[model samples]
Target: MHSPTLASIPPEVLTDNILLRLPLRDLIAISACDKYLAILCNSDALWQRKLRLDYDFTVPRDRPLENVSLKTVYQRIGSPRLFVWKCEHITHPVPSHRDFCELKVDRRVVSLVATHSAFYALDDEGKLYAWGEKVHWRRLLTYKFPFGSEVLPVHIKLPTPIRAISCGSIWITAIDTFSHVWFIPDWKQAYRIVNPMLEQLSSEAQVAQVESGWRFIAILTRSGELHVVQPRSGIPNPGQNLELNGSIIWNTPLRLATMPPLPNLPAINVGEEEALSPKLVKIAASEATIIGLTDQGHVLQLSIPVAVGESILFEALECGKIQWEYLPFLSEVEKVRTDPMYSPPETEFEKMDPWTQHVTRFSRVFGRCPPPPYGFLQMPPRIVPTPPCILKISEIFISDNDICAYSTGPSSTILIGSTGMRASDRAEVFPAHQNRPVAHFARTEHTAAFLTPQGKIMGWERTARGKYADEPSMMTIPDSTKGWLFLSITAAGCHFSGLAIEWEELDADTTNAYESASEDEGDD
Candidate 1:
């Protein structure tokens, strides 16, 4: 009975029971002190379990690249911090600055989608957390009301691990790992969307992505097929007179649940003689239209059935009257390929802030293989290049009538375009963001937020009379935590949320000095 000394405990118990259960900070501390504990803590199995538990990082079956370890992967992700802010409204109370409230989560956030009533964040391991007005809904008398004004984030359990989610005004559409489509009419429950076409299509090709607008849902398959449908079952109709945030009437009766592919997509030239249909890799939806991006760097738009007081007519759309239309560039892409003065823009790897660099490295190490914000490439194929800049649509953002195209080329500007595709072939570039290359962009109906490569946020919000401000304003965090860097931003209606990481003041100063010296060298 030697008083059960610390060294007497079995190695298995220490590794499985004690070490695995310890917090990261405590584990790191113990690992630094003991050589045996350090070896156990740095094991691939241990770190992979930790990553899956905290960040939803699924370890691939293939061995990682040389010199990469699970311990390094864990360190690269860092800890995620969430911040929220918005102008005050009568029903939803929010702070104008991000300092007054802190949103705590156990794991790292993978994506964020919001509606006017609530905010939802999906963590790395497929755990969904929700906050805001609609987290807890109660029916008092004839009308349903939210339980609280500003609810804190809470874990939401589902039948399976969800990979992607899109939000409507009051509902959410999600795709799980099994390739099954789920519609959440209420935040508390989810129903599997039962359709023969979806079942057949899913069997043939997996559902890679999903997007939801005010009334329509867009499904993109792994084989590059796009389908649009209006969800009718499991949807609680709020009646004809009760208006929701994004309530609108369809031009046809609500009987259209069929998934019809976009007819006659234009083919692109891959070589001198070979041509093929542009494989749609990304899609964005608004109230009245759906925007599509092909793997070849073409942007196409199609109008959906939206009306003031009529129902949607499926028969009208089936007659081949409405089809996808290409949004043409001002000059032919072939011309830029032959220009003598054109030089490719240098990659901005050196200009990225420390937090961005960490994310990029982590993505590469884990074989994630996609740029931040979304899985789109930094540059599209060369066939769709723009003049002088040699730009292609790297990302697209849309809400209501405002849509913007983000390009990655010599002049990486966030080019704003309207939903009206026929208005002009030339996109109206944002004056405030002409020179600033953004790493992320988030837009609501009245607000536009841009995150620079240096982790600074610039926003252009609607004025008092409902027009955009001429000059963009710097979005600042609290003075006490001035050195924090933002990783992502999202907005819906009027509310905004950001994910950031803390950096010490001294380390931040040193990093800024390094960045300044690098910029001077580039200038020289």
Candidate 2:
């Protein structure tokens, strides 16, 4: 009899004991040598394990969609690109593409958030990884974690997996899979909030979302209630010395309280009747304000009345003085139906107020160029009727003075406004993105990025010490991408994070094998 060969081994034993132990790169190399091995290597069970191990992703209870396979999902999230500006003061060449903190995460980054000097990423396994100034400064100056220099990302320790995470200027807030809230005052360890109200709230209702702004955190419950929490350690205390940085000397414990209902509610018109009140479904925050979205599409703005460099007073919060204000917006109908024409006024000073006339005269004398023959005649403002166009706001994003409102649809209508913009105030509509719809967008203190449907990223940024770019420009994908297509983009501080999948066009044979694996397996 011929000597027994490796091919005589049972396929199950070969896959489980031998092939599963090989690294992904090595496995793919070996699979190309034999057609039989290739079929076995592309098995659903094999790729499923690869997805879980390499990307920390698990398929939902729902079956895979037709023509798509687990292997495709695994390949799509494998490419994670990061670009950072080593010299934030320079603007010549774009920020160079580099490994995240010079170390590869390997796992897929599902959520990423940034503070001014730090970036926090949450992998699919709920593991929190942090890198940037916080990690480097602590290790070098304070010798906090001597080994952290090589580690790059300091994997935070927690009791349970974090389902979601948000970062403020100094604090990182997280909601665990169990619906418990955790605060990471420092980057290394996480401590769960032990307030009686929070404990009771968790048991009564699930946490729908958590958002962090500056040093304050807001928790939204599924029941539509909102709770604000300010950690004493991170917030500036007014009672302390005024000259200090304000956040370092606080000694009071964490202050947690419920937000008062909106004092000024906007009515949403139904078919024939108008609903006076609607429940808040989402929220976004900046340093001094919180923007809330109602289920009926009305936008509410709440100004957290805290002095510059001072913390919120808990007593005033309970008193209900801080309330949500109704924010009016231009509706799509008004944008299309009405046209505001700007023409030379009847007279040079027709619509010009006293202050405007003074400014125009001042500009002519001290201006770089001579003023127009008519000087600057202000355009007459058009008055929108009572009950201003209340837009159906589907979502909102806030970063400092910039606020972005997105309407419902795959191709959303985006309106860019500021924190305190009024109904009559004109909002910016991006002319560059008019033809290409945006799929994702994120903003840090100085940077804004938008991702298109076709794996393209475009944005503008103000360097830490440089001026903001006048127009958005397309970002160059790193050569390392090879055949990967970016699917998501996010920014924190001066750096950006992107997640990509392998393009199907890169390997037609592999793509076909993935889709026909079931049929091939049955034939064997």
Candidate 3:
């Protein structure tokens, strides 16, 4: 008897047992075999198994499995997503594309963050991986660490799974599932827990979020408290002048004493200052600034004052003396209104000086002395405009000197200080796509990417003169990859990187065989 072909096998058996065991790449190839086989290959059960095996995706119990499509689940959970770095080594190496040959990592990455010389990734299993310059890699590895070279990625497994990760110019911060925070300073040999206070606080109340600045780390606890930490090299003494090595050594987590109270929240205790005691819902940090969002949706900003010619390294050691300032635009407006310089000119001649009254009467008769032609009276002092008010911010991303904030309601993006333009004038600088909301936004030292609601990637880069070229252009994948669904995109230094999933289509021979097999099975 002739051997039964794949098309002649029962669809239920092939789908339930045989096809589910094949790899994702083979399943893609098999989907082209025919109409009926294509349907079986694309079934929910098959894709669900593929997702669990390939990507370690676990469907949430709260979701209704019957109503959700397998394709949707795959895109949302199974697809690989990562942050790509566009550094000099990755974008423009001396030998041209040589870095691509060295850019090989064995694990599947879920998220990544990179600086100028180093790149770090968190795998699906929450393991940390590092690869970059030899000096940087050696700094992160312990004396007994196995890796001897930085050319290959090295895996570092922590005691617990990492929940969040952030990178600064030369530092890294990660939070574990148990809410413990770890810090890695520039040129450090190993990561360390933030402090005993943070450890105790984390155990009591989980750390909801963590952010890194150029020289500082901001931690927000679930109890609504905000704490800031800075790395110091030597023991912190009262009056000793210490030199810094540009490496951070977090000593203790300090509760910021200047956090403003949220609107409609209960007043703080009798001795506790309102500014020091509001529960923060979210927090974000830039080079020297921190922005906090209260549960009541109030936006609060605090920044470290940098003196002229002061280095960030020195400031890192002096974090204890830094004071947080509240950014109240309304109060600033009131102060400006009360200033004597902004007061309207006096109309009553009785209050004017004798010389001013004489000059005014002469001007009233002689067509107003053409205002002093020169000197002090030539022009009034220029009035400084109020800072732009940013309300209802959904998310914010900061890189180098650029700050990008996404607002709700209209779903518009706000770019600040990226192009050296005033914040008020920058409202129209970023490109606008009608009705398409941005799902993700990221930036490097020079370029930025925006992922839209329709799964399209839009990107823009700074020109040689350091100005944003008109608007963003559509980003496309490589020609070699066909029928791939683009998931996320990021830009760094000079190159663009993205994550995508492959999709397959049915072919003619498979379609004919599937039809013939169906007809024959019906006759039997």
lDDT of 2 by residue, 1-524 (tens): 99986578898888878887876656766788888889888887787776666565554222322245666666556555443432232233333343223335766676666554655777877888876556432333232212113436767777677877877655677888778787667764455665666777767647888887764678888877888777644444345534322122232243433433443334444542234446777888877777887666656676775573444454555666666666554234354223222222466665575446666777878884444445544433322222224345566778657777765323445556788666466655543223234566666555666666555566666544333444467665434445545555556444565655555553787656654653454456
Query: Compared with the true structure, what per-residue lDDT tens digits does model 3 show for residues 1-524?
Result: 98988878887789768887765556656787788878888777677666555554433222223344664546444344332333233322122332232234666665555545555766667777875542443343221112223356766555567757777655677887678777755333335455777878777757888888755678888777777676544224423433233222335545453454344433323344444544567776766777666543344556555451234533443454544433332112232233343343455764564456657788999976645333332222222222223333445555556545544222443433332322123222232221225566766656666665455556656545344434466554322355544455544334445554444444787556645654554456
- lDDT of model 2 at position 267: 45
For 1-524, candidate 1 gives per-residue lDDT tens digits of: 45894357777677667877876556666777877777777888787777776676554332322234666555545566776656222112222332234566777776676666667888877778887655322221122113223356867667677888887654678887778776666656565665676777667647887877656677888777776666652354445433323332222122222223333323333463225555677788877677777665666777765652223334455555566776654122443234422333345764464356656788878966444554422332122123333445557767657666665322554555678665245565434344445666777656777666655566776544354444467665554544655656777655666776654444676645654653554456
Better of 2 and 3 by TM-score: 2
Q: For each candidate, what TM-score against the reference?
A: 0.60, 0.62, 0.55
Clashing residue pair totals per candidate (backbone < 3 A): 10, 1, 4
Worst 10 residues of 2 by lDDT: 139-148
Lowest lDDT sum, 10 consecutive residues, model 3, at 328-337
Q: Residue 398: error of model 3 in Å?
A: 1.5
Identify the leading candidate in terms of TM-score.
Answer: 2
Instruction: List the global CA lDDT of all models.
Output: 0.59, 0.58, 0.52
In candidate 1, stretches whose alpha carbon ends up further than 4 angstroms from where it belongs are 1-54, 57-73, 76-78, 87-100, 135-150, 200-205, 233-276, 308-312, 329-388, 408-410, 423-426, 462-473, 505-524
Using lDDT as the yardstick, the better of models 2 and 3 is 2
C-alpha RMSD of each candidate structure in angstroms: 17.0, 11.9, 14.9
